[model samples]
Target: MIENNRIKYSLAGFFMGVAELIPGISGATVAVIFKIYPNLMTILSKLRIKHLSFSLSSLSKKFQFDLLLPLIFSMIAAIILCSKAINFLLNNYEENFLTFLGCLMIILSLQIINFFKGILHQKKLFIFIFLGTSIGFILGQLDVESENISIFYLILSGVLAFSFFLIPGISGSSMLVVLGIYSPIIGAIANFNFDILIPFALGCLISLLLLPRLILSIYSSYEQSLLYLFSGLIASSGLLLL
Candidate 1:
């Protein structure tokens, strides 16, 4: 029984990683499809010192973090491994790439719409959407100026990406595109250029370490606000493709 479960967990991780590699697909969506979204989010949001210790002890006896940990790590690895190939395809096949991006963005927009339906009537909701849209548009227009990878920018990217990871319908890859690091960063990884990837990896590690605790605090006290902010971010990100 335990062995079967481990196989399933690994398979889930592989698929989730593939989904995450695609520009518009959400890792959370993959988790949802695999019937692990709620559990994953719960673990992510509630992770802290006490919970970590408990989870670690549980893992010593059994494959506790089995599915979630493998899934996340695999997804990250896949993204790094696949970045160059994806970029090559995108560059060589502009029409196909744009079409794929268009479809993905449309699906993402629908997801955002569904999310907003629950709070559509809120007086400030439109304002949030507008803000998100404006920001997304502006970000899309910004040019990538720096080719050199820096620790500060890498950390900033990780913080932004990690924050978006908690929100439904947001794509971390799309966030990378907006920040102008998507192509170069992916290229660095695809070619095994650690000079560029190392700092980004470090930033991602720090963000992952800190994110769970931050999520717990927000979920405990400011669920509504956090949801609004996330929704806005998603909406804006979707608008960027337009």
Candidate 2:
């Protein structure tokens, strides 16, 4: 039997939190890469909010709360602690950062393309690529200048970000950036502003609780097409970054 280690949980949570901070980096991808995503998802899938006491009792029977609590707390702490540093880098070196991000995005997209294993014919790929380019160009051109957003928008941003959190190649932070709330959200974290964090965190929690099962259901039905579509999106996001 493996001995329980709080240190391991702390490290896992820290890395996952770091992954969450980076635009185009998914916490789910980090977990999957680290070989913990399957079990983590299995655990999350079993969580129920039907009743606080009953849920806790049932969860205690199947999951290690001591181990999980540390990981969860650590991730939250890391996200809060790291936000200031990430904000600094993004604010000061945005051009260079975008360049690096663009390259990384292209590389990730290429990996997905290969994952298809010659499944996408040249003609189909051309079409998807064209569509991707068009969508990316449009999104890139759109001005996200408004920083004075409402709480509802922040929650919505959280929903969108967390919805993409499960998709291996998708980055929730990148989505937040695209939505123009990334800077403000990070600022809120750094300044300890709960007004925005409350709604945003709620959205994330809700999505984390609900979205994975839906995504799995969808993937079960359209795995190949979904992969192709996501590949195109990743390719486009890379173009937009440049």
Candidate 3:
């Protein structure tokens, strides 16, 4: 039974990891499709490694290693294997990739719109719309051309990029590309540079702790407005990429 559960999770993780590798493919969307979105988010959001004994005990009892370890390991394995292939595709088929990605983003934005019936009634809806669009547009425009990046900047990039990964339609890898760290990060992964990945991973962990809770709160309280704002961001991100 445990083996069966582990296999299921490993497969889920493989799918999520593959989605994470491709630019504009949202891992969160994959998780949602697999019906593990809420539970996975909750587990990661509340993860506390400092209390290792209690945390591990609780996780084993409630979440089950079969459902957690295999998924985590599988994702790490997939990322390591897929990074080079994704990089190759991005380099060779940039235009076609962007075109497909733009259409996907627009479609995802429409799906977000369908989630809210009375989005117009949300207070400051226009402000959120404007804010989201402006943010995406600015990110799309700014190009960090050099790979001589500082550790602080890498951590910041991870925090910002990974935070967006929690959003259903937003892709973290695409965010890294937009931020101009994608190539360097991919190179680092290929070369096995611990310096580049450690800070970024730490940042990712920190954001995982905070963003999920914040998202759940807003989702529960202002689902309409949040969806509206996210739709704008996702649409702009995709359109500008193209």
Candidate 4:
């Protein structure tokens, strides 16, 4: 049973990595599809100095080191390794690639709608949905040329991507594309360009470190609004893909 569970975890990591590779997919969305979204977010939230100390202690060592460590590390490794191949594919087959992404976004949007059914007040949420959709549509249409690498922008990307990770249906990768950082990051990985990678990595680390608490706070205080906003964002994102 333990061995089987390990295999399941590994498969989950692989799928999540694949999602991260795609320009319009999110690793967090893959986690949701696999029914492990909550667990992933919970683990990320616990990544702090106090949690590290607790994890090092004998009592928490088994849970932290044995299970969580392997799962998270494997996922990160898989994403890094798969990214190059995905970039190649995207470059070669842009149309087909985008079609697949559009379909996936549609499915995700439906899932968001189903998730909010019977709980949220639709009337109250529609306006937010409209606004989100408008913003997404406008953002999708605008294109920007890449600028010289900046540590500040890298950190900002991390924060924005991390926030998207917590939001259901919104793909962090898609957000990266809109912000014009997706290709550069992929290129850095493909070529082992540390000059571009180190700052981006730092940004991702900081954002992930800080995101959990913010997510938890929002979930605790404004659960309905959060869900509604996420649903809207997802719907808008799907439209953008189309």
Candidate 5:
């Protein structure tokens, strides 16, 4: 049973990783689709990166290695293997690709609403959904681009981009684009620029250390409202692509 679960999680991670590489899709969306969002949130929220020891025994005791290890490996493999094909598709057939993605996202949002079965008050639900949709549309309208990026901006980019990844519908790459740091970061990756990478990586670490816990806390306190918000945001993301 454990082995089977490991395989299942590994596959989930691979798909999530690949989805994140796409412009409109968030990895969290894939996590939701795979029914692993709760588990993913729980594990991430309790992450203890500062307490790491070099020993394998301590590592196993400190972390849920069975799940984490498979996710890490599978996601890494997917990023390494699938990026080029995704890029090719995006470059050549962006409209078609985004259309498909938009449809998928909207469908997922409807399913989430259906799951609630009208438990929420209509007015409150509509408000949350509208708020989320507005944010999504605003994000889609942004097209900031930059040539000169400072360490501070790099760090901020790292933090915001990673934070977006944790959100159900927001695209981390889109956040990067909004911050005008996406191109620079991509250039850094392609050219192996440590100056750009170190700060960005630090930002990601900061988000990992802080954002997950905060998200989990908010989610626990407002699961129903947040779900409505996320459903709306995801639907808007799809609309943007369309």
Candidate 6:
């Protein structure tokens, strides 16, 4: 039973890893499809520096390392092994690839919207969904100079990337596109350019530390509403791709 569960987690992580590297793909979507999204969020929100203990046993008791370990390792493996292939697909078959994903997103978004029929009538709820759509649409449309980019922006890029990664229906890569630092980020990955990536890495770390609790709070209160908003965000992303 334990091994089977680990296998499930590993598979989820592997697919999420692939999605994580792709610019438009949301890892959370993969998690949701695999039926691991709730568990993932719960484990993540439980993760806090305050929860860790100096004792190994106590620490292990606090976190689901059994689930986390295999998932993390598998994700790392997928990223390392599939990076080139993903880049190849993005470079050569972006339109076709995104078309399939776009259709999937549209279907999922429509399903979510259909669930909350009342959301259509409520001005405040509609506002949330519209705001989400606007964010995705506007962010996707943005273009800025990437040359001589500042460290501050690099850090900001990383923060945005990780934060969006936490959010459903949004990919951090899309956020990088907004900053015009997507190329630099990809280049940094290929070249291991610490100068460019370190600040960004720092931002990711900080986001990891901070966002989970806040995400948990908002999600706890407005789970359906957030899903409503995310559905719109994802639909917009899908439309942009199509």
Cα deviation in Å at residue 108, candidate 3? 2.3
Q: What is the C-alpha lDDT of each candidate?
A: 0.61, 0.70, 0.74, 0.67, 0.84, 0.82
TM-score-superior candidate, 4 or 5: 5
Predicted structure 6: lDDT: 0.82
Clashes of each: 0, 0, 0, 0, 0, 0
Using lDDT, give the best candidate's number: 5
The most accurate candidate by TM-score is: 5
lDDT tens digits by residue: candidate 5, 8-47: 8899899888988877788887777777777788788777
What are the per-residue Cα lDDT tens digits for candidate 4 across 1-242?
Answer: 76766666677778777776665566666665565656666667777776544435663552344556556677888877887777787799877777777777766755754645734646776665666666666756767556885878877776777677665655677667877888887798889998777877787788788887777676667655655565555666665555
- Candidate 1: segments with Cα more than 4 A from true spot: 1-16, 24-39, 45-57, 60-66, 73-93, 100-104, 111-123, 166-170, 220-229
After TM-score superposition, the amount by which residue 175's alpha carbon in candidate 6 deviates from its true location, in angstroms, is 1.2
Better of 2 and 3 by TM-score: 3
Against the correct fold, how does model 1 do in TM-score? Answer: 0.64
Model 4 segments more than 4 A misplaced: 1-11, 54-70, 73-93, 113-122
The predicted structure with the larger lDDT, 3 or 5, is 5
TM-score of each: 0.64, 0.66, 0.73, 0.75, 0.91, 0.86
lDDT of candidate 2? Answer: 0.70
* Candidate 3 positional error at 214, Å: 3.1
Q: Ranking under lDDT, best-scoring first?
A: 5, 6, 3, 2, 4, 1
Candidate 5 positional error at 38, Å: 2.6
The parts of candidate 3 lying over 4 Å away from their true place are 1-15, 32-36, 49-57, 64-92, 115-130
Displacement of residue 122 (Cα, Å) in model 3 is: 6.8
Model 2 sits at a Cα RMSD from the real structure of 4.7
